[model samples]
Target: MRASLIALVLALSAVPAHALPPPCSGGQVYEDRNGNATRDAGEPGLPGIKVSNGIDIAVTDAQGEYGLDYVDGRTLFIIKPAGYDLAVRPDGLPARWRNLQYHAGPALKHGGIPQRQPDCTHFGLRPQAAAATKGELDVLLFADSQTSSVKDVDYYWRDIVQPLVGKHGAVLGLTLGDVTNDDLSLYPEILRTTMSLQAPWLFIPGNHDLDFDAAGDEDSLRTFRHHLGPDTFAWEEEAATFIGLDDVIYQPGQTPSYFGGLREDQFAFLQAYLPTVRKDRLLVIGVHIPVYEPGARGFRPADRERLFAMLEDFPHVLLLSGHTHTQRHWYHDASTGWHGLQPLHEYNVGAACGAYWSGVKDAEGIPDTTMADGTPNGYARLRVRAGGAYALSWHPARGTDDSGIGLHVPRVLRKGAYPAWGVFANVYMGDAETRVEYRIDGGEWKPMKRVEQPDPRLLLENMRDDTADALRGYDRSPEAEASPHLWRGALPTDLPEGEHAVEVRAFDRWRGERSARTSYRLQVGEP
Candidate 1:
């Protein structure tokens, strides 16, 4: 994949200075069965694949040919058909589209009119092996690898990327957004690091990945496009249809700001595209921003409402996003304008560079970048069954165990005093359906109350930083925010003065029970 990308770049760079092709008005979609990356005799053409030019949609014919009225400045791409996979660059980026731009060097206009390309720009697809077509797929999800400098990139590789280097079980990978921190030039390095995972990776643009100097939202991602592919595209794997939408709208000016909302063109694209998907397949939408408002920010309600309506008919659907740098689970139903019988489940997966890679360095010289919500900076695994059933789990960057519960308890509490202490558990991938229970010293298990509050561990970490005489680490971590996966239960105050074990067991809807244990001491009264 890497070699193919380098070759394509060299080929594009070698185009004669004066020999620009006519406007690209059409293309062909051929099957490259021989793995030669080109059309050959006896290789059949693929039909029913959707091709688009931003505002208009076209389908390829039985001959694998497609034509569209030339539209300068509009990106041209094909919606990868189900049961097939596109060839990707070494960095796991899918090479399923053509830019249609004539120029190829740095002198190319930034946001000015895009140079037109020649007609008959074609796309090719390599057949996926039958073994690769297993109805089940494991997708790796990484969010907010917001590395700001070379050192930060190194930290990302050492701490986050290196752990999964040779574990190639995942069929696909996705970065929710913010692949880098404002420096678009670092995309190559980031891509190279991601390539180590050896899975086809999909990326969504975050606010930090934008070319802020661009004139408007339409061109704010020029630099991102030069490195990555189209801002929006879709593909399929097994029983799921994956759609990536660029929902960040750049407001260019002296004090530019980005908002989360789909542009009219994106809405049009979905309107034309969703009807083509089979109803039984799970619809997984990936965006950088959450659809519903979070505190004072988030995507526009109108845009979210329209999107929900579009998926109302689909029984199985999931939305994945990452921008807040926090891990959370949300359910949108009638109250949230979702018309589907089953509420839409949105998983705001945690970031790879937790707390922006801030905190003290570890023994390996990697930052102890735990997210503000107490989720360790890590990646997620999404397992989708052949029948559209799915399960999501998070893996800490350095742990081998699958215990998803993080327990917090005071080291010593006064015996016979009021029950002022409580046991807190942060169930990383938990949702409403998850059940959490706790027991003390092998006593009867009691259910814990789910709480929408900051993780106690994170709050303690924040306190430690706030009370320090000076900065304690590379940077102070972000303030603790209310975490959606937290649960709390009062600890018994009558226990004898001695060390006692506290066990927390959590049962997720899909993943079975997982238990974690911590010990706390009950001390004789002093105060």
Candidate 2:
């Protein structure tokens, strides 16, 4: 990821020697029209590009000159404007910001943060490729890479990242949060591994990615800022505007604690920044904590309502979050303070760590890290088109195609069984608008009820661990929880003694279809 000597020097020298206007303490935002990643003589400054210090928002002047006073060691990043793209590292990580650390606090055990110079920092942006700005975008979404050790890091790359190296059409990658498991020091290695995907990786800060030694919530992200850019910022692509916020608030003490809620500065930042976004563009918000409360200790209710009120003017919005380690979908309607025509969709995505990389080891020496909800440990793909329309699909880490469907049924049953049995389909992305059905022996399709219940496959897996003779695998899978995407239909028990075919099909609201098959053999006599 090294540039030529001359280009590197030119890029470095672009920052002004002296500080600019009072608010604009940083350097200039010049146009790298030729896309060589260097500031040339003729490339003029681009105006009206929004930049932020995670609290105050500033826009570039006609000369592309902008700045902000040093503000509590926060990352200073530009909101990538329409028609322009930031220079990227060879591996496709965006090189759009300068990490400004005025104070070095406690010595970092892991990552290193660069200290700011006496003057402000400078940023350069290049013109976007025509295809990128043509109103279509695909983004790769990962939640909870959460590597805790060197071995976990290896597992993440070999099992999770390697399979998806170049498989999708994603131009960029966004990891919702929990990039590491309480080990701030692993940021460098994790960042290195993630950059291998050859796409610009944008990260939000999770509760685990905190500095336990920090005195308060404000200073908790110091180490994260040292490795990645700001914990909160915004960037625009095509007809979509993406904003990532750090919602984890740390409280320092003997037993460190944190909660889900946006800070005062973050709210101020959003209040100032969101107005500049075009109303028609798709507004995509990424947060570490789901806006909707998942449990007693979930996101703060008042904060979520306030955020909804702020978004009322915009008709197109989707929120993405990760923390539960389970996959589920939540809709915020009038009861949730969202008065939009449709409920605000919040996708609490599954973790890339997949139950913290637990369960039995597979043949490939990788953990069978399926989520507690029976959803596979994997990432998500979001396809954003013009006019604020989008589609999402979950991609499993291993096995199966892009069907995003899991099936649970009995292998055999009695011809005239006394007890009733049913087939369950755990469609990972199914929503209220989804149509799910099942058919037996090529008979007519019968509708399956959308029921919020524990996935039977995960329940059985958990049962194996609970009723084991002795210690089983490395660790037991997570306890099964009620899942929103599960569908069920009763199976016929009086069928003749024969092997019968069972098929399940689902039509998702996002114009996607999935089908899976399994067999049930019925015997004439009882065992």
Candidate 3:
């Protein structure tokens, strides 16, 4: 009798008296190394990582593990970190850090990383319709739209953000951090403008967005979270899992403006969630600061190893970020194993505000938004295909008519190879006259190609104001005997073969010579 009663009790327990249908099917999961809402490797489950299929309040555990039982089809994602970067798969999905040689899909999906496609497509790339089954989806990327005050906000709207309002194609749009220029209050205005995008818009914090009054590290971003919601969170769209993290950890005594490390809370959150990522969907990480090195800033050697180790297993991963306000592409080879088998694509986008709104205003009354390195003020569009192919393009803001941004002569000797040797380049001049040249081992500076095409908008900012001379320095002079937008050069062969310095100079159609020539280092073959 006793054994039968015990068996009966066990059976009863197995059959939940009320068989609530499983929450949702096809839901996604991720490995959270840190249990905090952030996706770091230390802390456990967090307060705000987003989960769908009926919105169960999701939090990570002390062990950084979370299992939303029966959430099969819902999208699960992490809030991206601020200073850190997120990894992405080729299909526009978020790539897991582990096994990252390729995506997590079938055998046909894997391949070595290739050079990133340029962002030359239309200023706006549409996302695949939610119902569409065949082609890839699309995502929109904007680097720092950092605005310091209401006036800057106006510039953003009138010059850049306003133009993107009602467009379609990308299901979601991401701003790569530095949403404001020390004005957290402007976040709402920023969102209001971004909401015009008609898609889910997400943001990451930048060094300028923190609070200067927080008394302790625990509450540093209190006002920010209270207003901006969670600093980091995730969402799923179509076949991709998206994680947003707050990597801007503030030091106890440092001024809020100082930038240093990722908070332990975020790491705790990631530890709890990473293991639960769904096997089918691609992972897309959206963060503000770059996990990889920006050419301008060199490398963040301390956090690199920790970050790589936490995400080493994922097969498909792409990291997108903006901080340097320049255009750069970084590719990591598989030899050192910084990540899994997949090669990581680190895209550091140029700023939307364009050199801190540095130059003169055009007919639109907006400043010329071009970087010192020559990347014009613009936003990027990322497209993700269902089969796992992704592409990127840029949409430059319309600026001046005299000059614009375009490709420089392809370097025979890469940048920095020769200090004195420089290349001349130009933009927006309407098939205008141009020239180029170089010398190696003290050879003559021979002219190269004078390629010209329709100038992208970013390359043509603020042409109307001949009266004010704010950005007059940035103007290219076509007649100074030396081109501001063009370079003439070949590396001096006398330098060491391993790598040498190369200098580039340019003159633009505006008849204004640049303040200085641009220079970069190049690698030479050992004889």
lDDT of 1: 0.82
- Tens-digit per-residue lDDT, 175-248, candidate 2: 99889999977887888898888887899989888877776887788788767778888988887999999988
Off by over 4 Å in 3: 1-135, 255-257, 279-281, 294-302, 333-337, 399-527
Model 2 residue pairs with clashes = 24-67, 25-68, 110-185
lDDT of each: 0.82, 0.83, 0.51
Among these predicted structures, which one has the highest TM-score? 2
lDDT of 1 by residue, 23-59 (tens): 5588788887766556788878888778887667899
Instruction: Tell me the TM-score of each prediction against the true structure.
Output: 0.91, 0.91, 0.56
Q: Which runs of model 2 end up more than 4 angstroms from their true locations?
A: 1-24, 34-36, 89-92, 106-108, 111-114, 254-256, 294-296
TM-score of 3: 0.56
Q: State which candidate has the highest lDDT.
A: 2
Candidate 1 — worst ten consecutive residues by lDDT sum? 104-113
